[model samples]
Target: MAYKARLQEFSDTLDAEVIDLKKLRKLVFNGCPDSGYRSKCWKLLLSYLPRERKHWKTELEKQRNTYMQFIDEMIIKPGREATEHGGLADVTLDDHPLNPNPDSEWRAYFKDNEMLLQIDKDCRRLCPDFNFFQCASKHPCSRLCGKNSFETLRKRVEQTVLQSESVSRNRLGITNMSAVKRKSSSEFVPLPDGQEAHWEVCERILFVFAKLNTGLGYIQGMNEILGPIYYTFATDPDTECEEFAEADSFFCFTTLMSEIRDNFIKTLDDSQCGIGGLMDQLMSQLKEQDPTLWHKLQEQDLKPQFYAFRWLTLMLSQEFPLPDVIRIWDSLFSQEKCSTFLIKVACAMLLLLKDDLLRGDFPSNMKLVQNFPYSTFDVQKVLKKAVEISR
Candidate 1:
């Protein structure tokens, strides 16, 4: 489809209105009716249409099952082959060996392919980019919360959080790994009052991730990557409460993930094809904008991929504040040509930092490169520059 048409279609389907978690919760859980556009778009995007409003549950199940089958057939089998050439299989796992069964037929498959099913399993559980659980009940539940029972609590909390009027405006701030670890250890051990609800939202987010990209599988750090979105989706009027509105926020998030899955998958591929392409483009642009700096970087053998991998993989999730990340994601998903937009944004960042980067020595340059989005760089301005460059 033409980009404009695609954007229009998507906008029409999504109604181009900002979704509120409270309204979504009521629509999703309270048996509140959906507008025709919402119902139509939901079915169109999910590729499942129910004959009656009452049949949504059955339809959802069928959609989930169909999605799983598609992954098993189209993504997993093909991915296994594509990854066999020391591709995705080479990544080591800390937990367990790949395909422990020696005599099983899967072993033969693994030996020939040089693939690790265990890593695949880990990807299914951890990667926020791939949605592997759409067809199966493979998510880990807290042993403390009984199986699937937490879902009920989650729904209730979502409703309460969305409807309450006294919710705090304080955003969850980002702290360094050390600080987070110390705070986590010192925090009260008792499950927060809405712990189940929080986890429930996480579960749903995982489910959506699995459904969206079976090839990427689940990975660790995804929960952290998705934390702000979960909190935003569940934020309610009550200061202490968290709630989920219908599947609206979830689906909206699903759309955003769909837009960014390629960048996420690039992290897993040792080939770094996407990152390499971006690096090539960045180098070309750098040469044009600042030949001296570009030549210096080349002289030092400092490839863009060395430092920019995290920027591409996590969409700057680790480097930027959650609100800024969310803004970037919003622009990415809202725009029809997000992939190109992302490339341009990356270029803009490099260009904006060129002066500082050129002044630093190799080791210092590496450190400064690691600390991107430096004090002088404005993310929004960079984004605008990217959009223009992309155009």
Candidate 2:
């Protein structure tokens, strides 16, 4: 069968208690290696099976404990004593302890490992779209919630959002206000009713992001990014076949989300170690290639962060067409090492518009910088050029 047909078949079979363990094994092995759970692939498969819910819950708890141990180990290096405890710790503690200020730590972490952390957060939040085990109480992941338990916090969020029908509907904009306003000249137009549909989309997106990035929780901007995905999937379920294909889309999205989460949730500190270094390299190259533009920006006291931050952060989601975004993402998944390729794409985009950039006025140049791909640059061409440049 063709790939889409096979995917549809799998979706149809989602409720089946008797899974083809062999096929399940293949899927897990194929997908889980890069996730640092290669050895735990079998465990993940077992945990997902219908009969294993109780055992899965227990195993998941054990996994959380293991995750906490790993974090503790990293924080207190070997041969060093933990400050809290007198005994030798597994890893060295930071010279400065994590402060109570949430934004400070988040900002610092994002600045350092921008790519890795964003991807890490995005992946965790969106995994297993319907039954998200990662962010639920089932998983005791300290990396996400810190001291506050994930389950308790998640339940509170659900209750707060779900309890008030009026709030949920208004928040989701389920009502056509313009249409309602057209019919009535009332000062306060009531919101249209469709609470269940609104909540379904909201919850699914929330669950996806929450499960994918346990550390970050649900930030405000996440909803905006996910809005399009939810709309595209759920708006016309009958026509889009989303109802029939929900399971497949869920799994496919889970796989895709795993690949790109780092781009979304990173703080400045988190990028310093990985793509952060690459960003520095790219900036240097840009300076060498376009010193005039580079110097112009410096003369204005404008840093690359002002313009290029979103590009690096969201993997061009805000800039490119959704179709183009999907294509680029497909390429990202195809390549084992995609970071360098992404940088090359960024370079290609800059190079493609070099002529227009050189001729434009300061304001125009700034505008071009602000709206990357500026007018006339082709995303597909740039992506293709990026692949070639990386090679």
> Which candidate number has the best lDDT?
1
- The clash count for each model shown is 24, 48
Give the per-residue lDDT of model 2 (tens digit) for 150-169: 22222222222111112222
Which regions of candidate 1 fall more than 4 Å away from where they truly are? 1-184, 188-194, 197-200, 207-215, 236-273
Off by over 4 Å in 2: 1-203, 211-213, 223-241, 244-267, 285-301, 360-362, 373-375
- Candidate 1 vs. truth: CA RMSD? 14.4
Query: Which structure among the candidates has the greatest TM-score?
Result: 1
Give each model's whole-structure lDDT: 0.45, 0.43
Q: Write down the RMSD of all candidates, one decimal each.
A: 14.4, 14.9
Q: Give the TM-score of candidate 2.
A: 0.45
- Scored against the true structure, residue 129 in model 2 reaches a CA lDDT of 37
Residue-wise C-alpha lDDT for candidate 1, range 1-391, written one tens digit per residue:
5555544544443343433333332232211121223333333232333334456557555544443333233222211332434222323333232556564434443342222222222222332343322222222223322322222323322222121113232111211111111221221122343343234445444544554555765444455555545444334333211221223334544655565555556353444355455556566776876688788889888877666666665666665665566556544533344455566667678777777777878898887777775356766777777766655
